[model samples]
Target: MKILVIRRDNIGDLVLTTPLFRALRQRFPEARIDAFVNSYNAPVLAGHPDVDQVHEYTKGKHRKGFSPGWLERLGQMWRLRKEHYDHVVIATPGVHPRQIRFARFLNPAHITAFVPPGWKMFGVDQPVEYLGKDRHHLLMTYRILLPFGIEGDPPAPRIAFTPPAHSPGEAPVIAIHVSARKPSSRWPEERYAELMRALHERHGARFRLFWAPGAENDARHPGDDGRAARILASAAGLPVEAVATNELEGLIAGIAACDAIVCSDGGAMHLAAAMGKPVVCFFGESEAHLWHPWDVPHRLLQPESHDVADVTVDEALAAFDALRQEANAA
Candidate 1:
């Protein structure tokens, strides 16, 4: 049997869907399992052992206002139709109509998806209701396989990146992901610098600042470049180094090299969790229960004001200290 799982979303979302791939492979040991993801997130699934193939959809290049890239999308659809998949699972929490239409084109024998609330859908062999409160996304994505008796607390997100050659360096090297697409979720740069200094003094820990290139060019809200620079300048005498990468794979490699991560609630945090590294995550306006580091020893610091900037340096240091204690205990 052949199975295709579609989860065309961001890095964090793709990471959350990994357990579903594992479940499918476990249930059908001899089946060929493939994943369909967006180009930006394809690297997360590229070297996955459970997935036989990784199909990338370049949404940015192909999507426009109303029409989108109909010609290219249709051509890709035609190719998928010829794959003769035995089962197709729409592994996203909320299934979009366009994705539903695409699944139809695959002509799979069994179709499964999570149907949004208050909308009826036809042609799906199995449909699970989306309940997005308190529940983590890893468990949420695994619900799509309920009809096949694959039900449990899904395994944590795991990735298979070729671990970079071990470099003998400072112990407990902490990576600080200093960017968030949402401003509310971004802790102040000066505060981050303070946390770094504190960690360095307390544990002799070195720091790595991780940020995506062109993040400062985002028209919606441009500030990451300035933040990265500010962090470096503030840590002038400290052992803090900035590590920026344009490609997802490069970013993964950089994160893999770190012993742990201090990041906002975003892709970098999820990546660190997949790599089985302990994390100190700052949550602002984002939901903590749903998106916190999964199955990893970590501490999540949230502000009462609901703004990441309101989370004090001392508070962050305390969290990091707690994370270190947990790591040491283990």
Candidate 2:
């Protein structure tokens, strides 16, 4: 049997779908398992062991980089139509009519997707009931796999990257990601710097600061260049290195190297979880229970105001300290 897992979503959504890849490989060990991912999140599956191949295409919005403008994606879809996949799993939660229509265009023999309870999808050969938004997103995503008789306790999403070996006696390296798309999720720059100093003084920890690389005013991909700059200046005389990453791969590699990570709720937090690093994540207006780092010893520093800026530096430090204890005990 041949299978294709379609997860053309954001970086974190694709990361969470990784467990589906592993489950597919285990259930059908001899079957070929491929992925349909966009260029933005393709790097997450770059070297995954269970994934046989990745069909990558560029999305239209990020047109500055490559040929994902329009005609190219159509041509890519034409190629997929020729592959004749036995099963195509649309790895997304809830109803996505656009993606469902695209799945029909692929002309796969079978499609597994989540449909609304009373709605009918035209080409969905196997439909999983989307009860409601109650469980973690990963658990909701796993519903797409029930047709294959694989159920219960999906494995932690697997990332096929290794951290560079470090000396046991060296101070632990904590990664800080200052980029968050939502204003509610962003912690103040001075607070991040102060938290860094506190962590260093308390645990002798070095820091690697990671952020999206672009001007803050860039409307296409508004980055935290100014925030990163201010934080670095505020936390001078400390061992903090700003990791410049123009792509998702660079961010993933930087996170893989860290002993732990501090970031607001976004792709970086999910990447940290995939890397198996302890996390002290800030959850603001987003759904805290639905999106917390999965199967990891971590703390979510979400204040009553639902703004990360309201979470104090001392609160962040204490959260990380508690996480460290939990991680060590585990």
Q: Quote each prediction's TM-score.
A: 0.92, 0.97
Compared with the true structure, model 2 gives a TM-score of: 0.97
Report the lDDT of model 1 for residue 45. 86
Q: Model 2: runs farther than 4 Å from truth?
A: 65-68
Tens digits of per-residue lDDT, candidate 2, 136-252, equal 988989878999999999999778778858987788999999888888998887888898999899899999999878898988878878888988999999999999999888888
Evaluate all candidate structures by whole-model CA lDDT and list the values in order: 0.83, 0.89
Model 1 Cα shift for residue 302 (angstroms):
0.8
Kindly report which residue pairs in candidate 1 clash with one another.
none
